[model samples]
Target chain A: MKKHNYSAGPCILPQEVFEKSAQAILDFNNSGLSILEISHRSKDFVAVMDEARALVLELLNLEGKGYEVLFLGGGASLEFLMVPYNLMKVNGKAAYLDTGTWASGAIKEAKHFGETVVVASSKPENYNHIPKGYTIPSDADYFHCTSNNTIFGTQMKSFPETNIPLVCDMSSDIFSRVLDFSKFDLIYAGAQKNMGPAGATLVVVKTEILGKTGRTIPSMLDYQQHVSKESMYNTPPVFPVYASLLTLQWLKKLGGIAAIEKINDAKANLLYSEIDRNPLFKGTVAKEDRSNMNVTFLLNDEAHQEKFDSMWKAAGISGLAGHRSVGGYRASMYNALPLESVQVLVDVMQELEKNS
Target chain B: MKKHNYSAGPCILPQEVFEKSAQAILDFNNSGLSILEISHRSKDFVAVMDEARALVLELLNLEGKGYEVLFLGGGASLEFLMVPYNLMKVNGKAAYLDTGTWASGAIKEAKHFGETVVVASSKPENYNHIPKGYTIPSDADYFHCTSNNTIFGTQMKSFPETNIPLVCDMSSDIFSRVLDFSKFDLIYAGAQKNMGPAGATLVVVKTEILGKTGRTIPSMLDYQQHVSKESMYNTPPVFPVYASLLTLQWLKKLGGIAAIEKINDAKANLLYSEIDRNPLFKGTVAKEDRSNMNVTFLLNDEAHQEKFDSMWKAAGISGLAGHRSVGGYRASMYNALPLESVQVLVDVMQELEKNS
Candidate 1:
């Protein structure tokens, strides 16, 4: 049976990524060495690192724009700390738009550095919608926001214009849509969703924004140190970086984010339409702020829960269970998740409605 | 041709680990989903994380010793910063043994927290030997050292007895030999050399020694947070952790460290003896302080370097070049490296001597 994996990050990557990465583990480029056993500094792996960094810039259309791409270890959770350490200065203020869990986490870390001002938050409404019309402090060191909230199924439809440096945690939505990426001074995403596997985080930063903070930053957390070393600041998570390159290559071959955005839109529309149209189901997030990558919906009648789950399981849908915080089903349709898989999920949802 | 990989960390792993991990990537446990695509919270991966953590304790004989094993990302370099963040108090001091580059790196990070005392150092001699007879400060929050120096090919034969929390970075030597693992309160190793791959790090720390630091640690760098959450504090580097588990399983199947240590000793002895006896080459470090994992040697005559390099390449020996700082030849015979591979290199050395 073909499994439609909608696993939330560490989520579905392309099938070709699976095949090629598996083959690389067996024999990397016919070098007779497992990719797992090769040195990060070797010519072969260096080529991989270089190509991956270059490809990330090329795909984002940020090449020749003072952007440096780094495939670093530790997830976006670490970035929450690094962002503050690298950008936030002693006695300086940072403005943050708290959209969901991750954004709040970043805000929490930023507070440790200095004064962190939450411009606005949708936490009162249980983060069902992206906070809008948030004021940005002109004197703040930087403005930070989460582009998409996987747990709440909310995404920022439009970013706030600000004079301060823009930093966004696009962990769940990066490479899944087309955006004027150059607007953000710094962007980071864990390579689990719409990228690669779980071990590495993708950081794209404009070089001009770093090193202005007066405080001394630790080497691992310093963006300037990582950029200077070309992301090999320490032995990077080699496998994750390689797998991400494979995924980015797969994405490029499928016509970059512009093409994938259309497909993603179609997938999100199909499932959301079924939820909205069907009498037994309804969407959890606000309509306007709904995430195209992760679709959250609830059964109108709680009595049909068991039956709906069984139907989806029978249809080979995996990772449909919503996060514990949110009680409902979450279909994470990342870049690698095909439109047909979303159709399968929609059909299951429709079948449940008919049975109910 | 069979390649004998002697690349220092991210070097060689067991053949079975390669095959099994590759298979898992394609179809994990016959679940019809690549391990790369599965959720870290899924039962299958959870079981892997649990087993890997347990095996680390069991192999090190640290189970029931109040030691918690955490498989984290960001490598040992990240752990360098994390150690101080979690262990060093705001006004407290730390005692360190400056063995080599990594040790100095750790000391540099520790200085940012509070007073860091380098009790002794072998760096003046190019890190050719581990500093001995160092008196750890009784008032220090913790005593730190590197168990093995990969770059300089040196290993600590004995640890200083200290009442203070003992921390060691065993990035290149963990799991290769049997030791009184409880002697150290915290042990961290980047999983690339004797362990698994380059993405994950193994941190074994005694639970009782934590939370004493007065400084508020960031959530990502907090040991208590990771332990409380069972090392899934955030989505861990799944693939590296999983591969590390497979390598650990292979080690256990081969009768754990005691069994592998004998083989490791044999491989080291065979190669080191040749470096000492052969007229064409000489060992780098002091005889008593030589590392079993990495054997560094230099040619007696630099003019024969070209001929010797070609000979080894032809013999299918790869990654034998020493680190740039210690430019010569280094045969990194980790646990997974068969004794026969060492023999092949020794044979090449004999050939070089005859030709000379």
Candidate 2:
């Protein structure tokens, strides 16, 4: 009984990924060795690393655009420090758009490097919507933003136009929708959300944006060092990287991101429509800025809480409870979550309204 | 058939770990979810983390000694920078013993913080032996050493007596030998060897030694932050951590570190004895400093290289090729490798001697 898994990240992956990844652990490529035991420098693993890197570029349409992909460990949290270490020059200021907790975390790390300016923040309103109409300073080292806020259930529908090295952390919403990815000079995502599992992070950066920071960066934090070594700067997170490749291959087989985007849109529309029509439920964030990935909403009446909880649990719904900050139900419909699963939740929502 | 895995780090783990890890990916603990899909904050995973951390201290005989365990990402390479950031004070110096490639790498990262003094180095002799009788600066922030050099096949048989904080990088040989666990203030190891898979790193630190550097470390790099949150400061490398827990559990079932040390010693003795007795083979490193974990040796003549290579391959010996820096064969017998595998290798060496 594999329930409808809506875990925000480390969420649902394609069933095929689960099967193949398990098989690899037992015996990788029939090499008579577990994937965990093989050397990172082995020809078999080198091919996995190379193919995964190339697939990232091919899917993002950045293959010939001077973009290089790196699969790193430490999740997006480490990227907060690495981004500032590799991009913020000595005594240079960085501009950040404060959307949510993760965005503020990035700002905090950048402040350690130099001046970190918050252009505008929706924090006062509890980050229910993306802050807009903020002016970007051209003198800043780079402009940083997070594409989607997983906890707050708000997302940036449009990115601001900026010339000075546009950077984004797409940890929760990468590959969920189609975007002109080359517009940003740098992009990083923790693979847990929509890509793969929880160990590896995907970093796609334009090499030209690096090496100008002027600060003496440590080798592990320096993007150029990782680029030169082809992400083998240290022994990579082997199992995570291999599993991520399996998920990426599954996406490609289903016609890449463009095809999955349609399925995702359908899932989002079905659930959002039910939230809007049902009398017992109410949506949580601003309607226009609602995340297509994480749909946060609440039961309108407190008396219905226990009943609604039991109903969803009985209907095989898991991870529907919202984050502590947002106090409600959040259905995280990532790329691997099927439309049928979303409909099951909608039916449960409709049943609650009728019984009330 | 499972081959005799001799690859360096990211080397062999218990076969039980492999079977259980593969099963967890499909359905973890009958939770109707894959281990790869479960939330790290969930009760099931929190139990896993708590048990794993407790097991590390118990195995090291550091329990109830104010030692805290952390499973982090970025490998031991990231620790190169973090060790300096968390310990070195403003304008303070640190002393390091350069034993091999990894030891030198740690020294390189420490130079960026402040003055870094290399008390001794065996680089001139190509790291064939450990540097001895180095004086530690009492005024230095800390003293660092690597317990085993994986690439050069040399290890420190005895540690230095120092008043300063003693730190060790035990990436290649952790959990494979019994040590005076209370002697060192801090120990770190990448989990690729003798533990589990790659991605997660194990850090055991005496908490009292922290926060004296007076440096405002980044939240991710701060050991205090991880300790406070109980290693859940951020999303951890979930799969790697889980697999490591499995390996640790396997070790405890086989009577813990004291038991594994005897088996590890036996394997090393059987293989090294053959290397010394075989006319066609010679050990590469100094006799006394040879590592019990990684056994490096070479063919006495280039003519025998082809026949010996074929013999080992036919016997299902994998990853016997030495590192490029040490041009010979390296037989890494970690905790999981059996004495039977070493016997198989010794038999092949004797057969090669007979043919020659």
Per-candidate TM-scores read 0.99, 0.99
- The RMSD of every model to the true structure, in order and in angstroms, is 0.9, 0.7
lDDT of 2 by residue, B172-192 (tens): 999988999799999999999
Which DockQ values do the candidates obtain, in the order shown? Answer: 0.86, 0.88
Shift in Å, residue A301, candidate 1: 0.6
lDDT at A129 for candidate 1?
A: 92
Write candidate 2's Cα lDDT for A1-356 as tens digits. Answer: 99899998789999999999999998999999999999999999999999999999988889899999999999899999999999998988899999999999999988889999999999999999998899999999999999999999988999999889999999999988899999989999999988898999999999999999788999999999999999999999999999999989999999998999999889989999999988888888899899999999998898999999999999888999999998989999999999999989998988888898
Question: Candidate 2, A322: how far from true, in Å?
Answer: 0.6
Docking class of 2: high
Best by lDDT: 2
Off-target runs (Cα >4 Å) in candidate 1 are none
- Per-residue CA lDDT of candidate 1, range A92-189, in tens? 98999998888999998887888999999999998999877668989999999999999999998889888899999999999989899999999999
Error of 1 at A99 (Å): 1.1
